[model samples]
Target chain A: MMTYDALSFLLKAVIRFGLYMLLCISIYMLSASLRKKSPVLIVPTFLSVLISGSMFVLYDARGQKSGLDHRAAVRWLCEKPILFTILLFAAAAVLLTYVTFREAHLRRTVPDRSSIKESIDHLPTGLCFYAENGRVMLVNHRMNQLCHIILGRDLQNAALVWDDLCGGSIQPDIMRLSTDSQPRFRLSDGTVWSFSRTQLPDMFQITAVDITQLHNLAQELEQKNIALEELYQRLKVYETDVEVLTRTRERLETKIGIHSELGQTLLATRSYLLDNNENKTIPVEAWKRSIALLRQNIVENAEQFTLQTLIQTATAFGISVEVTGQMPEQKDVEKLFLEAATEALTNAVRHADAKKLHISLTETADTYRICFQNDGKMPETQVTEGGGLGSLRRKAETAGGSMQIDCHPEYSLTISMPKGGTENI
Target chain B: MTRVLIVEDAPMDRQLLELYVKQSGQYELVPSVESAAFAEFCCRTTRVDLILMDVCTSLYANGIDAAEKIKQNFPQIKIIIITGQPECSFIERARKAGVDSFWYKTETAESILHVMERTMAGETVYPESTPPLQFGYITSDELTARELEVLREVVAGESDAAIAEKLYMSLRTVKGHIQSMRDKTGFRNRTELAVRARDCGLIIVDKETE
Candidate 1:
């Protein structure tokens, strides 16, 4: 039992100190507006102020019933206003802090804006927005560094007058955007980008990317492929040329062989014909023209007309025939008549079962006539396909003569050579 | 001795006959002329035992024509038709002309000259393989001797142009000769003429080859 007032004052000091400490704690907890505090803190701060005020009010209402000197307590509590102010300040501070934090949560976040940046410092790629005409606008730091190192100029928003980065000006055709497939540009830095139409067809997006090493590899590969293609085409051309040359050589060889054989035969014929001294040889050219003429005649006559030699040859066979009329003044009329008659005789014997055959020849002033009549009648036949007679007719026409045949007549035969021929006998 | 007259158009043929006649001393070679006209003149002027008539002769005269004419004038003279090849089926023509024989130039030899002498003395000599034994038909101047010669040339396989040149005549003349031959023989064409000549043995030929 120390002094009574001292004990009471000591008790008041302890409670006041506890309340100030608690208010300080509340201020400290509510002041953290950025952090989410426990829900317990809201009620506790409100109750602390409410309870302290209510206690002061209750004591005043009870008067003497409080069993203490209420007047003095009430008057003391009212005169200080410190405890109420402290509780109000603590509650206001906490409530203001909670509202501030709730508003902050709904609004945009705030950062330490002291060092805000407009864009990335060093872009991931060598990205630069160039104009469709290869004009550089703004670029990232990586592009900036590349431009400085490659072009050696700040070139702020510079229309790319040159393409030093790619070692040369890229063909502007890439920038010609079209709806179809576009051209792709691979920079030396391996940055690959395709030129595409922008919002406007006239404009394009020529973006760069860090494909330096890739571009180099692709360019090297393209060069090697081009060289290989050129070599392949050259080889193909060479092969064709070689084949042509081989064919030419073969044709020349064949011609040479034919010429040599022809020359030898011609030489032999010439030597035989010109051998007045028996053993002397003659040049082939001497008879070559005659042989050529004969050959031409033979081919032409054989193809178009019946040849006289074939008739002559027929005469060599056995055939019976009788001839009459005056002996003409033909130098070889006798031989010709005999040959023709012999051929007629051969045909009659081989083809016709004739009893007898009559032959006659006559010569007028300008016309000559020849005929052979057999006992057997001619056969009635149509013109056959690929007829020998047709071919013979062709041959006869070649000798300036016309031929006709009457298959079923009493005098069925072929009469050749027109009537208007001079008899130079 | 059998006096024989040889009428041949070719000099070579006359020479060959004369050479064969030389081997037969019994036969006297009077002369080997080239034409029937000359042979006829000789026959009329001289007394010949036998006349050798060639089947063909020059353009002006023919041996067969000459033989027929001589037989008409000289009734006692014997004519023998001689030819390189039988050119026609001359049936009974010799009998009508009073010809004693028909001889082939290929078959007749030096011994044939003696045979002719015996023939002139009334001995019948004929070829071993002869087929012209017609029972007695007349072959009109079926073919003139010269015409026969021309026909033979045709059978020899010479072209009209070539033959005309060989005979020293133009092609037209040769064609005329051929036309006349065809007319007389009743042949439609040369092939028929040659075949007939071969079938009748008017000329020797390789039938298969032709």
Candidate 2:
């Protein structure tokens, strides 16, 4: 009997512990699913259930071993149900604390709409939005101030703002906005405002900026440009005047040099006419009076100056000379031909006793020739080169040309020199 | 008597020619003209044996042109061109124009009447050379053609290398020419020679003399 009672007590304790374990497992699984929603409550809930179950098992085993009455065992088992209920209530309180904490965390992470509204209100530029229905959805403080300044009145809606700004001057429906956003609005207070709009799904944002300073700067630049153009025109006129003055001065200088040259010729001629041994009848005073008369009728123009001087000088010696063809543009080449002619004329009169002299100028592709032939006495014998003829030959050769002297039927000197485009020497 | 025509632009020069013609006693003064054009017309219209033509006149600058025209028509008239200008330059042109003689007004030692008498007796008279003109330390005629070539570039402010390339000469040759010119001219440097050459217009060769 004692063995049977012992066996029965052991079996009963095992059965009760197994049932408590089942209950613990069920609550654990149920709490695990709810733990994801309020994880902070999971540990406390699990500890309460484990403690209450372990206390019940310890009380029952002690009662049974001490051979306690069934009522005592029953009372010990009853304490387990009260402990379970108390554990359930503690789990409920833990879940409520977790819920409160989560709400506070969400409030910290995401900002409220009021903060965004406050930010837009203090923006530097004017900001406003219009709903798809064309109603004024939101506006900042700057936007209101822009409306008052540009429109000359407070406007409630974007349509009213457009009407006030354009003043029916531009058809808003037909005007291309984004591609041509340069149209600006001038306020009554002389301030300039440039507006732009961006379209969104529910509404469109409009922005405006004061551009009065920029407009003033552009106007100032344009005015300066006009002034600069006028100054440039004035400078061009002054440059032209300077060029004319320089040309006139050059002409005057050439004339003065020529006059001085003429004066010297007159003095020389007076000495020559007075030195005539055969003309003892002509007084020196008479020649001086004649030379004085020659200075008064000189040509003043520069174009005819040199030619005129030559013509007059040749007339004094009874040399009837004529020139044809365009004058050489290069002064040096022209001088070469003129010098050779003088030498030939000298030989004709001094040596050959020639009376008539004929000079002809002809030009080829590479050379210009001055042919000097006179109706003078041909040499009785072969003529040798003298100081004058030798010098003439050298001049022609040095200039890359040649000189030919003919002493046959006619006394002639033909000098051919290189034309223009000669190397600068 | 020899019929003389005086074409002089200057009043004094014409009177001087008139006085010379009257004093010669062998020639009679024709109507004196102040222009080559009037002289040409006179030679065409009237009998003129001798024409005393100043190279420059009021109507036409070059008496050589008038002389050529007159000689083409009347091959019998004698023309003498007288001027104080550098005879070196005008001699060839006067010779080609069929002038009988050329006389330097200031430099000629011979009497104008004697040259006129010789020209009438079928004589062609011209001076030996131009009056001597000095540039720097050398005479104008002393500058050789090659020296003048180097001097032009120096006056134009070109470097030796640039001158060599332009003239198709070596750098050493260009420098040699410059140095030679400086030595011959007694100039201290290239700049002095160049400036004097420019002032005197001595470097007359342009391109063909190269």
Per-prediction DockQ comes to 0.01, 0.04
Cα lDDT, model 2, residue A324: 64
Taking the true A–B contacts (Cα pairs closer than 8 Å), what share appears in each candidate? 0.00, 0.03
Residue A214 CA error for candidate 2 (Å)? 31
Candidate 2 wrongly placed segments (more than 4 Å): A1-425, B107-110, B144-210
As a whole number from 0 to 100, the lDDT of residue B23 in candidate 2 is 52
CA lDDT of each prediction against the hidden true structure: 0.51, 0.64
Per-residue lDDT of candidate 1, residues A23-140 (tens digit) = 4544454554324453434455455445444443433343334555456755554345445545554664565456446546633444333222234335564445556665654456
User: Candidate 2 chain A, which ten residues in sequence have the lowest lDDT sum?
Assistant: A170-179
lDDT of 2 by residue, B1-210 (tens): 889888775554455567556755678988786656456545544578999887655522367776887788679889998765442346777889889998766532226787898999999998776555587677756766677667777766678999999999999999999888777778888867765654443432222222
For model 1, how does the per-residue alpha-carbon lDDT over B53-143 read when each residue is reduced to its tens digit? Answer: 7754543344665677777767677777776544353324555556667776554244456557766877655454334412113132455
